[model samples]
Target: MIRSHFDEDLKQLHREIVDMGSFVETAIASAVTALKSYDVERCKEIIESDKKVDEMERKIESQCLWLIARQQPVASDLRQITTALKIITDMERIGDHASDIASLAIRITDRSFFPESEMIFEMAAAAIDMVNSAVMSYVNYDMELAKATEEKDDIVDDYFNKVKHYLADVFSTQPHRMDVAIDYLLVAKYLERIGDHAVNICEWVHFSQTGEHKSTKIF
Candidate 1:
C-alpha cells in the first residue's frame, strides 16, 4: 500500500513538472512575439506571468522534499526526486531568462532593430524546443530524447554567434544605433542562457536514468 501511494505521488510530481515546463515555454514564446511586434504591453504581461512560474517552482519543490522525507525512497527513487529538485532550478532560471528577454524587448523600441530580429526569433524557437524536449524526457523517462535535446543547443549557440557578428557590423557602420544593437545582443545572450538551462535539465534527466551526468557518475 505504501509503495503504491509513493508511485502515485511520483506521477503527480511528473505532471506538475510538465505544467511548469509549459509555463516557461509560453513565456519564451510570448517574449519572442513581443519582441517581433514591439508590443510593450505583451512584454509587460509576460513579466507579470513569470510570477506564476516562480510559484510553481516553490510548490513542486515542496512536494519533492516531502516525498524524500516521508517516503525514504531507495536509490532509483531517490535519484528521481533529486533530479526533480535539480531540474526545477534550471526551469526557474529559464523562466527568469524569459522574463529578462521580455523586459529587454520593452526597452528595444527602435524601429531599426528589425534587421536582425529574425535571428533572435529563430534562436528563441530553438531554446523553446529544447526546454519542451527536456521536460518531456523527464516525464516520460526518455533518455534518448534527453540526449538528442542536448545536441540541439549547438543550433542555438550558432544563432547567437551569428547575431553577435551581424550586430557588431551594424554597430560599426551606424554608431548611433549602438544602444539598440546592445539591447538586441543582450536578448540573444539571454536566449543562449535559456538554451544552457535546457541543456542542464537534460543532463539531470540523463543522471536520473544512468546515474551519470556528462559521463560522470554522480552517485
Candidate 2:
C-alpha cells in the first residue's frame, strides 16, 4: 500500500546491481592485464578475488528474492525485479570467464611470450563499455542505451574472431609455441564469452522495458 517503500527498495536494488557490475568489470580488466604482462602474481590475485564477486552475486540474488516475496511489485516493477535476477546470473558467469583467463595467464611462468595484447585490449574495452551502458540503462530505465550495447557486442565479436585467426596461424606455422598459443587463444575465447554475457544483460534490460527482446527484429 505504501509507494515510498517500493521506491526505496527498488533504489537499493539498483545500488546492488551496479556494484555487482563494477566487480565484473574489474575482474575483466585484471584478467586482460595479467595476460598482457604475463604476470603470475596478478593472475593469482584475480583467481583469489573471484570468490568475492561470487559472494556479491549471491547477495544480490537474495535481495531480489526478498523483494519479490515481500512486495507485490506490479507490471514494470515486476519486470525490473526479474531482470535484476537474470542480470546477476549473467554477471556471475562473466566473472567465471574472467577467472578462466587469469588461470591461463598463470601457465606462462617461465616464458616472456605474450600474444598480441591489442586484440584483447579492444575486446576488453568494448566489454567495459557494454557493461557501463547496460548499468546506466538499468539505473535510468533508458531503453536507448540498452539497445546500443548490442552494437558494441558486435565489435567485440569481430576482435575475437581476429584473435582466433591469428592464433590458428601461430599454431600451424610456429608449431613450437603451440602450448602458449592455446593458452592465448583460450584467453581470447573467455573474453569473447564474457562480452556475450554482457550483451545478454543488455538484452534483459531491454526486455524489462519493452516486454520483448529488441534483438528479435519483428515485422
Candidate 3:
C-alpha cells in the first residue's frame, strides 16, 4: 500500500512538471509573437504570466523535497526526483528569459527605427523547438530525444552570432537607430540563453534516465 501511494505521488509530480513546462513553452511563444507584432498588450500578458511560472517551480520543488523526506526514494527513483528539482530551476530561468524578452519588447519607442532580421525569428524558433523537445523527452523518459535536443542548442547559438554581426553593421551605418538595434540584440541574447537552459533540462533528463550526468557518448 505504501509503495502504491508513493507511485501515485510520483505520477502527480510528473504531471505537475509537465504542466509547468507547457506553461513556459507558451510564454516563450507569446513573447516572440509580441516582439514580431510589436503588441504591447501581449508583452504585458507575458510579463504577468511569469509569476505563475515561478509558483509552478516552487510547487514542484516542494513536492520533490516532500517525496525525498517521506518516501526516502533511492536509486532510480531518487535520481528522477532530484533530476526534476534541477529541471525546474532551468525551466524557471527560461520563464524569466521569456519575460525579459517581453520587457525589452515593450521598451521599444520606434519600431520602424530597426530593420527586421530573419535571424531573430529563426533563433526564437530554434529555442522554442529545443525547449519543446526537452520537455517531451522528460515526459516520455526518452534518452535519445534528450540527447538530440541538447545537440540543437548549437543552432540557436549560431543564430545569435548572426544577429550580433548584423546588429553591429546596423550600429555602424545607422547610429541614430542604435538604441533599437541594441534592444533587438538583447532579445536575441535572451533567446540564446533560453536555448542553453533547454540544454540543461535535457542533461537532467539524461541523468534521470541513466543515472549519469552526461548523455551517451556519440562516436
lDDT of each: 0.90, 0.80, 0.90
TM-score of every model versus the real structure: 0.96, 0.90, 0.95
Off by over 4 Å in 1: none
Candidates 1 and 3, the one with greater lDDT: 3
lDDT of 1 by residue, 38-107 (tens): 8999999999998999999999999999998898898889898999999999999998988998999888
Tens digit of per-residue lDDT, candidate 3, span 82-172 = 8889999999999999999999989976777555666798889999999999999999999889999989998999999989998999999
lDDT tens per residue, model 2, 146-218: 7788678888789889988887898788888889878777877777777788788888888887777755622
Stretches off by above 4 angstroms in model 2 are 110-115, 214-219
Lowest-sum lDDT 10-residue window in model 3: 210-219
Please tell me which predicted candidate would have the highest TM-score against the true structure: 1
- Each model's RMSD to truth, in Å? 1.2, 2.6, 2.6
- Give the Å error, residue 16, model 1: 0.5
